[model samples]
Target: MSDNTKAYLHIYCAKNIIVDEQKFSELEHIKGDDLEDVIKVSTDKHIVTANYDLPSNSVFNSRIKAKDISISCPLLEAGKHYVISIYEVTPEVAATEESTFMDYVHAEEIEKGYSICLYRKK
Candidate 1:
């Protein structure tokens, strides 16, 4: 894909394993100490999409919006501890694994018209 290509990803992060449990519900269950810690970090739509080519060592700050709540992402860095989940919205190819994050986790088609792929940073 070209550099201008924009891919839609439902980005999420948490202080604990609650986010992982939701992403990989079919896998072996993961237990977390507190369910309240599983706060939705941020969605791709909230951030600036123009800065897509972030350097490997670059660090930036952003906000996380969950429902009526909005807060900082806390020293957000590129290619750090993050799990990216991609939803196939169309049959046409828009982005690839190389242009995005790393570590292919799992992918599944929940129904005939819906599909999702998960990737974890290495």
Candidate 2:
């Protein structure tokens, strides 16, 4: 498959969570069409941003390891928590295009010491 066809996976965590191979492997099975739909709907309704969306025509999939959420997101921090989400986006949508403070327009508490916040960065 072409690069576009290959899924882009990202990892983010909330405050010093030990992430190891086992954690990553545990998350490997979490990606699929069903999870993608949940992410799409949740992001579309909650996140308020014009540039925030998953790449359309490209597979939108993700998984979580430890307290980190892994998806095709940019500007992810290793010790910060984020809610896994998806949104239809153009294939050419550069990750940098949405990397701005204003683009981070939402935040919500998900788990103790873990909160979901909009992020756009490398």
- Leading candidate by TM-score: 1
User: Which segments of candidate 1 are over 4 A away from where they belong?
Assistant: 1-86, 89-96
For every candidate, C-alpha RMSD to the true structure in Å: 16.6, 16.8
lDDT of 1 by residue, 8-90 (tens): 22343322222322333332333333321212333332221110111122256444322211221222333233333324432
> In candidate 2, residue 90 scores what lDDT?
26
As for candidate 2, its clashing pairs are 13-80, 15-79, 54-87, 54-89, 75-121
Candidate 2 weakest ten by summed lDDT: 37-46
The digit string of per-residue lDDT tens for model 2 on 4-98 reads 22232222222221122223333332333334211112111222221122222324645333333322234333333233333233223323235
Cα lDDT, all candidates: 0.31, 0.30
- In model 1, what is the error at residue 43, expressed in angstroms? 24
Error of 2 at 4 (Å): 1.7
